[model samples]
Target: MDATQQEILERLNASGKGTVLEALDISVVEATKEKVVASMPISSKHLQLVGYLHGGVSVVLAETVASLASVMNIDTARQMAFGLEINANHLRPKRDGQLFAVATPIHMGRTTHVWDVRISDEKEKLICISRCTVAVVDRPPDDGDPLFKK
Candidate 1:
């Protein structure tokens, strides 16, 4: 990765520190305008009643990476991205190890971005396939609120 890409990766990883991503141990390993990748390790906290990876975990990973990728394609100073829609199909069950989600763009337009996110196990076995649509909207004029500062 180039300096800029490395910077983005580090920023994204750090941004997770106080969010659900941190709670789920998700970290962005790769990031670029064309693609983004994140990984989450499976543990008891991530499993369902049957002890398999929960479908919701896969969906979270899918949307996180897709939304992050969409953010990269927009003008952060003037625009923001939000997940408009997301669909995931779980193809396999995993009990342990790590899950990697790779997100690549299917369509990038002025108002929206569509991302294809695939989740796979350590050995490259596909676990889930997901598609996410993100809407890019102009940033509302920043109020003095700290939450809107950045």
Candidate 2:
């Protein structure tokens, strides 16, 4: 991987340390300005009571990859990406193995970005398809901001 891609992976892995991403075992395996690839294990932690992967788990993976893709394309020093909306269709039940999600941009705009994320199982069978919209916002100034006060 190139420096940019390596940087993206390092940053993402670090940020997952204390978040739901960590709990769900999500990690970015590859990334570029136009696309991102991530994966999560389909363990009991991600399964519904019915023993299949939870739909919400798929949505989280979708939003995560899409939002990360949006962030990768922006100036992170001054901007941040937030998921504005997301929708996912779970097409297959996965009880084991890892699920991979690949996100590609549908629209990349100054204020907003749209991405299509496809999740497939280890066998490359489609598990979910999702679309996510992200809003890019300027980072709030840190100086004297109550939210940033420590």
Work out the TM-score per prediction: 0.91, 0.91
Clashes of 1: 0
lDDT, model 1, position 37: 93
Best by lDDT: 1
Query: Residues 23-118, candidate 2, lDDT per residue (tens digit)?
Result: 999999988888899999888989899898999999999999998898788877678889999999889888999999999999999999999999
Which regions of candidate 2 are displaced past 4 Å?
1-4, 143-150
Residue 103, candidate 1: C-alpha displacement in angstroms: 0.5
Return the clash pairs for model 2, or none.
none
Tens digits of lDDT, candidate 1, 1-150: 234777778777876778889989999999889999999999999999989999998999999999999887877767878899999999988999999999999999999999999999999999999999999988789623222244
